[model samples]
Target: MSSITMVQAVNDALREEMRGDDDVVVLGEDVGINGGVFRCTADLIDEFGEERVIDTPLSESGIIGAAVGMALYGLKPVPEIQFSDFIWPAFDQITSEMAKMRYRSGGQFTCPMVVRTPYGGGIRGGHYHSQSPEAYFTHTPGLVVVIPSDPYDAKGLLKAAIRCEDPVIFLEPKRIYRAPKMDVPDDDDYVVEIGKAAVRREGTDFTITAYGAMVAVALEACEKAAEQGWSGEVVDLRTLLPLDEDAIIQSVTKTGRLVTLQEATKFCGFSSEISAIVAEKAIDVLEAPVKRVSGFDVPFPYTLEHVYMPHADRVLKAIEGVMTY
Candidate 1:
């Protein structure tokens, strides 16, 4: 085991996978000699050379489209989008080509690729640099959406995504990329299963379901709730597309109250999907209406970035509302 930052853990996973699998290649703008904008792919070019660590032009569409082609031809491509906010140019390619490859070809074709991008706020990046767009990809079928909150899950889940037969959208929370350090397994075979949810904390009073950076905020709120004699269980949704419905339902059933949290906008966000699941399946066990603490329905602001994010205070307020109801 080794204590490292989320960025280091990601680097380790990419390095380990590329070393083990000759088909695994890393490509994106500034991903080669420049080591990516966030340095997540740093030092890879030195070890793997330019053939495997490619630096493409500043075209998101081209980066992803080429990855799809490579995947179809038997190469495992890991493309970096730089930032979630800049993934729009490649949205059509991702949603239309890569996602539907398997089904559209009647299982004759498969794109086993992983698209990595940094997402969420808290880094003072305005609208252009910071955005939580996981919902857009999660809504698409045949794509796996994953967001990790810490170093351990980040490394494990990323390794799993690279090995997955389907295309995986790995959204790394930039906010906590270097803020917290944790002991992550250094074993090359270590992997966190995809489509599984992790329980960060255990309680019986209420449940808080969150993912990505919001998992930390939810855990902080749980600590405050304990002071008020309310115990809150926190569930980290590792994968959003093949959501662990059983884990969520089981958590809500025990707590009798649910509070969904995310950094995305309130309307039509991933939080709403989880809230709907609890409402439809666990309505009988619900003690109060399922509450959601999410960003307002507006563009992320430069001056109000902190205000726009759903913090511990906002989550705590939602917890109180649901528990008191």
Candidate 2:
């Protein structure tokens, strides 16, 4: 095992996968020579040369379109979209072409590609660089949405996405990209199964469900709540689409309460879906109404970025409220 940050773990996953598979290639603006904005693809161009580590034009649509073409040609293309906030331009290409290729072709063809992008706030990047738009992709039928909160999951889940037969939206939380280092396994085959929720903390009071950057915030809130004589369980929903409904129901039923957190807009977000699922499956087990701590409905702001985010204080308050309710 080697201690590394989430960024380094991602770099390792890409490097390891590319070394193992001849068909695996990475393409994005600045991903080749510049090694990506976060350096996740750093040194890859030096190792794999220009053909495998490609630098494309500054166009999200073109990047994804080319990746889809490569996927159809039996090449595993991992397309980087720079930032989640900039992924809208490629929405049609992603949700329409890449997502529907297999189903529209009626099982004869498969689009095996991974769309990687840095998402969420905390770098002080205004609206254009920071946004949690996982919901839009998760609503699509053929896409798998994944968000890793730590270095281990970042490496393992990425390797799994690369080997998957379907397209995957791997959203890296830019906020915790570097910090919270861990001793990640150096094995190239390490893979955290997709669609499973990891329980970060165990408690009987209430359950806190979150993913990506919010998982750390959920753990922080659990720590604060612990000091107040309340215990909260933290469940990291690593995969958003094929959600681990069993884990969520089990946690909420054990705790008899639920408090969800998300860095995206509060209204009609992924947290809403989680709350609904809990209500449907574990209604009798819940002691209090589900609570959601999330970002404001307004656009992501520059000056008020911290205010617009859901911090540990916000999550702790929600946890305490649900425990007492």
Candidate 3:
């Protein structure tokens, strides 16, 4: 095991997969020569050469289109979208082509690919660079949405996504990409199962469900709640699609309260989905109304980002509200 940043672990996963599987190829703008805007794919070209590590033009649609073609031809292509805010240009290709190939083709062909993009707010990226768009993809069928909070889950889930037959949208939380370092497993074979939730802390007062960058914030809130004579259980939802419904139900059942956190807007967001699930399946066990601490229903701001995004204080407020109710 080694203590490494999330970005470095991402680089480790990509390199390990590329070395083990000849079909695994990476392509995106600045992914080859520049090693990606965040350097998640840094130094990959030196070991894999130009054929495998390709640098494409500045076109999100083109990059995803080419990846679909490569996947159909039996290559596992991992393409980066530079940022989640820029993925809209390739929305048609991703939802229409890459996502529907398996079912639309009667199971004869499959697009085994992974689209990696940095998402969420924290850095001073304003609106263009700090949008949490996982809900858009999660709403689509036949696509797996993954968001990792730490180096261990980031490396493991990424390796699993590359090997999976379906297309996976791997959203990297840029806020915690380098902030928190953990002892990540050095073994290349270590792969976290997709569609699973990791319980970060065990408590009985209430439950906090979060993913990506919000996991850390949720944990902080849980710790603060503990000081106020309340215990909160925290669950890190590693995958949005194929969500771990059983884990969620189990957590909410034990705590009798639920508070979900997300970087996206509250209306029609992923947090709403979790709230709905708890309402439908575990309503009898709920002690209070399911609460959600999320971003406002407005564009991410440059000056007011700290207020716009959900933080530990906001999450703690929600937890306190649910506990009191």
- Give the clash count for each candidate: 0, 0, 0
lDDT of each: 0.95, 0.93, 0.95
| Residues 245-322 of candidate 2: C-alpha lDDT, one tens digit per residue | 999999988999999999999898999999999888889998999999999999899999989999999998898788
In candidate 3, position 185 carries an lDDT of 91
Local distance difference test, candidate 3: 0.95
What is the per-residue lDDT of model 3 for residues 1-325, given as tens digits with 9 covering 90 to 100? 9999999999999999999999999999999989988999999999999999999999999999999999999999999999999999999999999999999999998999999999999999999999999999999999999999999999999999999989999999999999789999989799999999999999999999999999989999988999999999999999999899999999999999999999898899999999998888889999999998999999999999999989898899999999999
Task: Please report the TM-score between candidate 1 and the true structure.
Answer: 0.99
TM per candidate: 0.99, 0.99, 0.99
What is every candidate's alpha-carbon RMSD to the true fold? 0.6, 0.7, 0.6
Per-residue error for 198 in candidate 1, Å, reads 0.6
User: What is the overall TM-score of model 3 with all chains considered together?
Assistant: 0.99
Residue-wise C-alpha lDDT for candidate 1, range 127-218, written one tens digit per residue: 98879999999899999999998999999999999999999999999999997999999899999999999999999999999999999999
Q: In model 2, where do residues sit more than 4 Å from their true spots? A: none
Error of model 3, residue 232, in angstroms: 0.3
